[model samples]
Target: MSVKENCQKIEERILKACQRSGRKREEVVLLAASKTQPVEKILQAYYCGIRYFGENRVQEGIEKIEALKDYKDIHWHLIGGLQTNKVKYAVKYFEMIHSIDREELVDEIEKRASKMNKIQEGLIEVNFGEESKYGVKEENLKKLFEYILTKEHIKILGLMAIPPYFENPEDVRPFFRKLRQLKEDLEKDFNVKLPHLSMGMSHDFEVAIEEGATIVRIGTALFGERI
Candidate 1:
């Protein structure tokens, strides 16, 4: 199927998931994970109504962002692990950063945003599923949150996570549920409403949406498997 057709199918599935969970389709955001995808194909998805795109690498993402500069209203997101050295470019190129996992990275982001006079928005990535992953552990979230609040230039929009891969998407449901509950708990503790839950990928996005994911990251499902 073409990118447009793929997008239509994904949208239908997302709507179905939202309906099953008693949620409105508008409450959910579809972010096309465009890492390693060509500019032409990305444009195809763009024309098909995908305004939000995510990339994994800083350099590659910046390149695409530069190439697509003429495409107004395209919101670029950094969804993979970000390095401290790339914080400046990330703040300059992308509108949102989704992989903030540590205090040091947050500091870097704050410094760069301060220099640019821009308010940087990001999601706190929770590393609950794997030991070797790149997110802040669930237990340490509050400490991180508190520290982040002091950084006037950076705003923690919500939480994001990449659960362990399971052949059956059902197995990933627990991870999504936990992230949602964590969000609820954190909101109550901090008295702040997190508007975005950046979880789920192409394989298990429907389940993620069913469990309260406001933004679902989809790549292969929209752009086909990466070469």
Candidate 2:
């Protein structure tokens, strides 16, 4: 299918998920996970009415951002593990970082944002005890939130998680639910509103939306398998 057709199908699914969960369609942001996609394909998605794009690597994201600089309306997001050295460029290029899993990254983002005099918004990545994922464990989430609260230049917008993959999307529901509950618990504990839950990917986004995902990162389902 063409990008336009793929987008139509995805939009329909998003709408259905929103209806199932009694949420507004406008509440969820469809972020194209344009990790390895070429700039032309990215633009195809843009013309198809997708304004949000996510990149997994800082350097790749920078190249795309520079390439697409003329399209000022596009919102770029960093949705993968970030190295400390890339924080400066990540802060300057991406509107939000969705893999903040450690205190060091928080400190680095704060410093970079302060240097640039910009408020860097981010999501705390919570690991579901997955050995391979890069995220703070659920038990340490509060401590991380407390530490992040002290940073003047960085803001925590919500939580993100890349749950272990399951062929059945329903099996992933509990992980999404846990992430939503964590977001709620943090809001109550800190009296802050974290509005974006950056969870879900191509295979299970509908489930994520049903569990309160405000941002759904889609790649293959939108752009086809990576070339």
Q: Go through the candidates in order and give the clash count of each.
A: 0, 0
Residue 87 lDDT in candidate 2 = 96
Worst 10 residues of 1 by lDDT: 128-137
Q: Largest TM-score belongs to which candidate?
A: 2
Flag regions of model 1 displaced more than 4 Å: none
- Report the lDDT tens digits of candidate 2 across residue range 1-227: 99999999999999999999999999999999999999999999999999999999999999999999999999999999999999999999999999999999998999999999999989999999889889999999999999999999988999999999999999999999999999999999889999999989999999999999999999999999998
In lDDT terms, how accurate is model 1? 0.94
Error of 2 at 83 (Å): 0.6
Model 2 residue pairs with clashes: none
Runs in model 2 with CA error above 4 Å? Answer: none
- Encode model 1's per-residue lDDT on 27-123: one tens digit a residue: 9999999989999999999999899999999999999999999998999999989999989999999899999989999999999999999999999
Superposed Cα deviation of residue 100, candidate 2 (Å): 0.7
Candidate 1, residue 198: Cα displacement in angstroms equals 0.8
Q: Give the lowest summed-lDDT range of ten residues in model 2.
A: 124-133
